[model samples]
Target: MSEKSGHSEKKTSLFGNEYIQHYDKDGNKCGTSEEKTTLFGQTYTQHYSENGDKCGISEEKTSFLETKHYTQFYDKDGNKTGTSEPKESFLRGKYIQHFNEEHEKIGYSENKKSILGTKFRQHHGAHPRDESKKKIVQTSASNNDSGDGTSASNTSSSGKNFILWHVFAGLFLILTYFFWQQWLNKQAKEAEEKWKNEVKIIASKVPGKWLGHASNTVVTLYLTHLYGDRFSAKVNFRGSDQELQMDFGKGNYSTSLFLTSRLHAPLYFPITIPAYNKNGVVLIFRGKFANNGKRDVFCGQLIFDQNWKILGSFQDSDGSVGYWSVGECDGMPSNISGNWEGKWERGGLWNPLEVNQTRFKLSLKQEGKVFVGKVSYIGSRGSSSLRGEICGDYINFKYRYGDGVVREYVGQAAGDHISGTWSQNNSFGTWTVSRK
Candidate 1:
């Protein structure tokens, strides 16, 4: 039955030191042959029986020198029986133990004590009372011994206190915001009240009325060195309603007169008297003054006011001795205050010829009782200038022509229209004026 006699299969040991060869009944190598060995530095060998059953295993310390192999034998129960060779090595500076099939150490030797002995023992489940476990147990015991439960109770109390403090802080902030808003509203109301009081005080300081007079009149009597007598009339005004009224008596009148012309004659002349708050006076007066067989209409306006009294009057007619001591209407000419355009009869009936049509334009301005203006004449003789004055609605102006002849004119102004008469001299027939 020796394998070498070819009656049994020859097999190699797993450690590569032995081989087995199978044979047939004729004692020749037959069937399949197998070789098994440990790979690399594996120092352990496991063995099986002919029936492909795991039987036993052997562990050996391998060396480089002696090519000795370890063998394992098993009974029917697959337990190791014996071992053949053992190995040792000093190069690794450590010793190893070889084990039998039953996991019992067959030979034991020490190589070196492990530096990570506790870790190794822990991995192998051999460490007693590990440090992490010990700390956990101690902590559990300490928690159990605190009889008042102070740690947990303190933490819960602190959490409740935090919630209460946060609520109180939020309420305080809300109350502060409301109080600030109330203060702002109070300040705004106070400011508005202050502004209203100031305005009321300022309104109380203005004056109630203006100063001026209602009307004034002036009359002058002149006696000639020979036998003639003359009467001069002038009016002064504060405003339109405040005026001076003059009444002339019967006398030989040769002195100049000025009148304020009116636009239209009213049924009754308006005599306005200025009051404190009532309508202010407009100095207007119209009447008739006679000389020789002709009657001339007189109109005048009061142009100045002083201390609520009429001080100056302006007559819108031509006159000499214009500036008097009462209030000088110096160099005043009677002319309507408006725009005027009109045509006049050109020539006289002597030659039965009408040539060189006459066109006239006049404007007057008044300051208080005094007035100044200009008149333009457009005719075949070209254009000329005349001085003018304002007295109510009556206007008079005169200009000297190149022929050394003086022409006098009278006109009236109302609203946007004016009309008047022109005389070549004081005795010539009158030329009519109509607003264009």
Candidate 2:
């Protein structure tokens, strides 16, 4: 029979082959016999049979059983360059192997391990210490038990933490921006409100007045109407200084001036004639007027109101000789209501012979006097109007003639009489009226 089938074959070898072969549970020969061997000065022995089979074939020891331990060579930069099986002359303890460009072992570790240790410490010092490195090592061991690499966990955890940090930071930034914008809008609104209130407070301190004027040779007048109606005024030149007063029919007169009222019936005058009435007898006079020896006889009509006051007088000749009764009068009358007269002089020369009149008219409706009228003459030129008042004294009224000339009068009223200065253009003059 062949030696493989012999039961008592000689198994002696010069390598001292005391070993045991391992087998699977099915009794199949799974490994070779174990034997002890020595290489270099280290005493590690193989745990396998002479046929290259494992002796202790447990799962935990499979890697050691299948691989042979060999010395690896590295460059000074710690890059692996060569590998070799351990030999009899190999040094024990920690050592570094040196290799050439061809990956051949050219040198071995010497006392230079001190230098490499120093370099390793310096490298660690230069970089930030990873406090999680120990945990990473433990995790690596756990991964090795499950046959997976440890690098995947480190990569995944790092990426997850990085994304989480960015998301939180982005949300914080967005909220901050919105809050800042709202604060700015609030500030702007408050500022605008404050400015508007300040302007209003400043504007409240101004005075209220319509308009006024002043002049040397003129009396400026501003007239306002209470009742809205249009009236007319005419200035007639009756006669020069010391002229006879005679009856003149209609269509005969000298010079006549006419003025009109505004849309609201208020007359604004800038001038006035200066005079005042002394006697109170209201005279109704008709005369022929002359200017530079040119004469024109003018016929006129006179009337008074129920208060024994002259209302107004109208002249048909040259449209001159109208008079407004000054005092309190309500309506028209049939005759002159008061005997009123006045005289004026300029540059020490008597201006002309002129008749001025005033009268009071009783009001049938209200408790106070109503109308006031006045008239003045230079040659045949004169103006007249009837005025209304509330306080009876302190009269304010306006008059305008057909020639668009407006006059405003404001003055005081007394018993059965009124006196004030009328203004037109840049001239002013005193005037008075009385009851007949």
Candidate 3:
């Protein structure tokens, strides 16, 4: 989980004790340190030389309030070498002051906590009298390009500190990269979830019974099966006198998603239904959501010809310019008169639970809110008496069968459609009819 140690360093945890063996850059075993914590919560780290002789010790302690902590160091033979302690300044912020064995202030290091990680800028020098000498050394080191990497005046101890500083700097960069990658991955996942939710919302509007008229041509579009920008729909093309066929388009009639790029445009959508005519004319519905009195409707025109120029009307290959709009969906319809038809279902012989369909049709003649209709079973070729009254979008009536059984029909009329339940005492069935 961390990479603060050198490649040549080996860590050992024995009997819950923290033991570490240090190694030089050349892979030579240099020294070792063993840290032990007493029951009183005091930690002592014993340092050893390459020859397995005791060299120094580091003692760490914390105040009772835990607001302050200190670590003191000792040399071989138990002599104080230095101490690194923290100091706070309102103007300068918090920093660590380093001292030599003589207990004289040598230098200070500033510790900054950032979003990336903790960073340190440490400066070390001799007494004020040796300031001139320090400048001369720095000038010489910068000028001598042929000089060895190490400074001539610095002791072996300083050399060790120099290597350790670079090691920590490298580790800092690595830590930053690790954190950045984590942030990037999190953002990508969030964007993906957002895209999925947007698809669902837009898809919900797609699946519905949409009816629109363009001149004498009547279009009934059934959008269904929406998932991730893709959906299936059946386009029923009919004239003013033509009945809704449910299936009229030739070939695959499907189109790929251009939604991501077009979603932001003023044109909310453009669905291309292909292979409509002998010349392979593609009809694209370019539209937006419109309030159709009692409900939301998808009102737009079917752009013909070239795919790119979808902004306005175009001449279709069928010799006439095209336009269409959906005036009804999920809610009540304004008009209930037309050729309305659906299926009558009952339990089948093979499976008692499975419902089977029988074609039921109604030709309604509406005057104001009341309507008298002719109900016909397709195979029988015989018509029956049907009368229904419309209240808002609801229609209910009584159908007298040929055998004198009167079934009550209660249907909800929404957007040129009526569908409800029919019942006769213990017998019941569902009836749904769509306006042609």
Candidate 4:
């Protein structure tokens, strides 16, 4: 049947004259034949059967001021049955080759020119010796010429070699990737350990309260020891940022206070100078951590005017300087002294019981910065005495809950509410209290 577009599908073309057509559900080419033009002005037309099998192709080319034509033919099953081209010398004599239903070449026709005249002679049952057939026949003869044992042995040895090479390559790559990951992990661990060491060495040296006294206000400093050598210090004062004038003071304020056999350079800690000042004296605290049987000391220095002055200078008890102890301040005026609605949770890692949530009543009294409280379950299980201390926003309390079990409460205070974790007998849970 002549081809026509079907199923509302249109032919698609990459270029003006070239088209790529798709097939229908039954694998039938349901569109017009495609034509392609080459850059050299060569045109190729492909014709497909209704079954979507390419049945024929025609190529036209112009070379050396002459036009050439080439055509190829295919069977209904899309097998190349024959071709018509004068340029191929081999096909000039054998113009056509006939094949059986199985596509095995069975015969061919050759045009011969003898003394009589040019005539076509048909040779039947004479197959063509193509490249594929040559390789098959040669391989069969080679395997047969040698003993069967030798041939099989060679094949087996070659396969074993190929498999061994691939196995070794794969294992090598896996080991390389594993070692690379291990190296990365080792680097990270070393960096963390180094940081911890630095922090620890810094903390041990500067272990006291630092103070800066100006004429109007006193700047209190508290250094909280943290993991490694890292520490967080709280500076308590109220004024414009420029009012707190500070200087590192005079002398080498860094010294090693611990015993270590190795001789190492002193490690300096970071200290920011305050802008607040009393009169014209600027005060600052400075210190350095020490290693290897050395002691590290921090001292306060007061500079009179902009130059170093001996009048306002102060230092830690390093024989020539004086120091003061830092004190805690009551957080806010809002005292947590009233009845509160409380929740008590009973499970922690140390407790064997399933976690339970219960309600309780808490009575608290605050005296200065100290907290004394009692908590009782709703069913009157008897209340326990509580004692704790509040530091800034942090509150910590502990109570004995009858059975020799001590419950500790640590949390932050938020106005009228307190929320924190509670731990008892190695078990821990959270609690919340709101003013009632």
lDDT tens digits, residue span 1-436, model 4: 1122111122335564533343333445443344544333333444444455554433322236556322333332334433322222443432334333344544433333335542212222332222122110000001111111111111101112233466787789999999999999999899777645543544554445655443235756555665543344444432312112122322223222221112454244333333323323233333433323434233333222322121121221222222222333333534788899978676422132667788888898988778798888787668888886655554666667667666556555678887755544324466788989
* Highest-scoring model, TM-score: 4
Candidate 2's C-alpha runs over 4 A off are: 1-369, 372-385
lDDT of 3 by residue, 339-404 (tens): 987875543211237676777889888887678988888779688878766544545566676777
Local accuracy of candidate 2 as per-residue lDDT tens digits, 1-436: 1111100011224796533232332334433322222221221222233245322211111125756333322222233333322223334433323223354543332111133232110010100001211100001001111112111111111112233466687789999999999999999898767544533432231112112111111112222221211112223222222212111111222322222222212222121112212321122322333345433332211211123222222222333323233234344322323444443222111113433333222221222444455544535555556454433234445556546665444444566665544444422344555554
**Candidate 4: deviation at residue 168, Å?**
50
TM-score of 2: 0.18
Q: What is the C-alpha lDDT of each candidate?
A: 0.33, 0.30, 0.45, 0.42
What is the Cα-based lDDT of residue 397 in candidate 3?
A: 62
In model 4, which range of ten residues has the least summed lDDT? 135-144
Model 3 scores a C-alpha lDDT of 0.45
Shift in Å, residue 82, candidate 2: 99
The per-prediction CA RMSD against the true structure, in angstroms, equals 40.8, 36.0, 22.6, 22.4
Query: Pick by lDDT: which candidate is best?
Result: 3
lDDT of 1: 0.33
Report the error of model 3 at residue 405, Å: 63
Model 3 stretches astray by more than 4 angstroms: 1-158, 238-314, 327-436
Q: Where does candidate 1 stray beyond 4 Å?
A: 1-339, 346-357, 363-373, 379-382, 431-436
Span of 10 residues, lowest total lDDT, candidate 2:
120-129
How do all the candidates rank in terms of TM-score, highest first?
Answer: 4, 3, 1, 2
Candidate 1, which ten residues in sequence have the lowest lDDT sum? 135-144
Give candidate 2's error at residue 398 in angstroms: 1.7
